[model samples]
Target: MSNYDELHRFLLNAANVRGELVRLEESLQPIVHSVEYPVQIQRLLSEMAAATTLLTAILKFKGEIGLQIQSKGPVNYAVINATHDYTMRGVARWDESLSVLPESFQELLDSAVLVITITPQEGERYQGVVALDKPTLAECLEEYFTQSEQLATKVTLMTDMSEPTRARAAGMLLQVLPSQAANTDVKNDTQFDHVCKLTETLTEEEMFSLPVNDILYRLYHQEEVEVYPSHPVSFACSCSKQRSADALRNVDKEELLQIIEEDGAIKMNCQYCHSEYVFDSVDVEAIHNGQFIETRKDQ
Candidate 1:
């Protein structure tokens, strides 16, 4: 089987262009298998995961990036989050019993809005929003780059579910670098168009099965490319008992006590990791007294 859970970056030696390729397997299985998602939802989640990974690689700061889709159609919402370390998690809410799977973005979502958020560890957070008017996620993302970043960008995403046990996703991104006075003779548009056209030749099978170097060679054999070391990607959730306890403290005291009295305890579930934090009367009392301690249970 082809190696997964890896991200590779490369630069076109002759053109002012850079690119990234990412393949996901183990990192994606837990997210897709966390709940019983239909094949269509599963595939969209995989693509979102791959797109998140690609976007995370391009960040210049230490932060977390998130891609979220909100709609009024069969698919209500979908989101994927990735940190600078490449840890990723995602989920989608949808109508499960739909008779037919959507064949296009417009079919799957109504009045859809795509939101991209970036929060740095210290600096201010940033957000960009765009309409999901395009047919594919790749085209929508490409529009974001053009409208928000003013850069010529191309994105290709693919997911393979042929294997029963493992679902795989892979994507590639190419962006034109800013022009420099020293290279005024190089036509940025021509270079970007050429590289983008070559990248368009990649097939789903090649994206999922070929190694990064092999794929680059196959696509740009006539050009000089400088490949970089691969970055490891994995599925990791940042949820913890302490975080859950802190969140619980924000609830009204009377409501907390009522829940404790009615159900014996107040349970908080982390949607990202599916971890549960149970707070009994004692814990609630401590929290009310500003002496709360972290307690956890895996569900």
Candidate 2:
């Protein structure tokens, strides 16, 4: 298999618990290049990239999932978007006044919020918000799942800005299937506690660089794990000049003209891919008024 892509799911029949392993190398690193970001920001982007890929992989949807962080500190907004296909791209915005990077995810995102938005193509958009907790990105994700989904889930993400500028982010999720019931006397929490105990034994190297099978063996070799087919993860963006023109067409003619005069041209930049789309005066005029008296400029 290629070193840059893939997610594997494993299920243990007797325990009603399921797990997933995802390692993103080239898949997410390309996303980090979209904007000029600090090392800390790259780490956060890696974690969110992993999270979105894992979350969307489990969904039975045709649309996209967006993980966004909005902050009141140096970082204005950091967002990663992905789909069931695992195609992804991300970008972040920060305040210009900010110069130094903070100590941790929470430090960098002081007074910020993490929001997860799931947009299914044919249905409604669902969103969940969690206040930044603990020092790490993984902890914030666990909190979001517990509060918003009421699921007993644990997530561990590791980011390395070391030589080669490589990054690896992976996650393991466990929950008692609806049919599997815990003892009423002990509450459903005990099962989750037991799972967390086992899951905590996971090591950084196993998560960051190991293949799905090896990683699962390290974590759950004692149990019966049925591994399923894997899905490839990747860095992809859906943006183009035609789409930009379509967007520009939505604005009023006067507004488009005003924007052209002010900016010298109506330019739209895709945040995900860093692609530029420039509409000169004539292009802006066509888009605004929907007028097309076809006479080629060269003609």
Candidate 3:
């Protein structure tokens, strides 16, 4: 569990490949426990969280990246969002009638689509979509990279739930740099394959139990590896009282007042963190009057 909740970026300079490794624990616990998720859902969500964090580390702008899976299987929807700094939050929805959910990714998310969205602070938003036809989420992501970027990529995601209460997840990404792709020779391609093969040898026990540098050294000690400074990843929800109040302005004032009269307050609950926001008649009145009323958080 050492060096947990951090994302590390490294490069095998000689191989002309860039890699990202992330191990998550404390940050993942809160997201998975936000609801009474079954073991199946918990593992899937944790993997998605790790995958999102790994993808976020490549952002060059001050914005956010969102990964969403939409399907018609037992699990209808799941989404994870992360900012450039590695702060993340996620939520999932599934059919509750089934007592036992399927353990496989494709079984749980039949007829699914994986959507990757990137929004820059000052530029147009970009989105890429690929079918979730692969057996594993990691392979689906690899497919996305190969299709969209035309770059050879490999992704591996793992979760450890032996300790039910203190679950953890980690992921690794290896991709050929586009700048190097144009000039890649047979030897360069062979080196890239060698690096990917070494990464594939990682075991769940070694990934969860060892530190970042130790894991890298064990896998790439013989290569010219350059590791960068690590960044901490945390669970951070973007929901807020003010934002909830602003959302209320969209509805007719009379409708909100009616809800207040019946339920005593207009309640808004954040699915990501399960935080409740309550707004009374007065708050509604202020909000409809174009005044942003600040309500109490987490009722």
lDDT string for model 3 (1-299, tens) is 56889999999999888999998999998889988899899999999999999999879999999999999999999999999989999999999999999999989998899899999988999999989999999999988887787778889999999988888999999888988665333245787889988998989889988888889999999999999989999999889999998888899999999998898988889888888988888888888888765646765
In the range 136-211, model 2's lDDT, one tens digit per residue, is 7777776776666555566766665674466666666665555553322214556556656777887876566666
TM-score of 2: 0.87
RMSD (Cα, Å) of model 1: 2.5
Candidate with top TM-score is: 3
* Per-model TM-score versus the true fold: 0.94, 0.87, 0.96
Model 2 is weakest, by summed lDDT over 10 consecutive residues, at: 290-299
Q: What shift in Å separates residue 292 of candidate 1 from its native position after superposition?
A: 2.2
Q: Give the alpha carbon lDDT tens digit for every residue of 243-292 in model 1.
A: 77778788888899999899988887878778888888788778878997
Give candidate 1's error at residue 21 in angstroms. Answer: 0.2
Q: Point out the worst 10-residue segment of candidate 3 by lDDT.
A: 180-189
- The candidate, 2 or 3, that scores higher on TM-score is 3
Question: What does candidate 1 score on TM?
Answer: 0.94
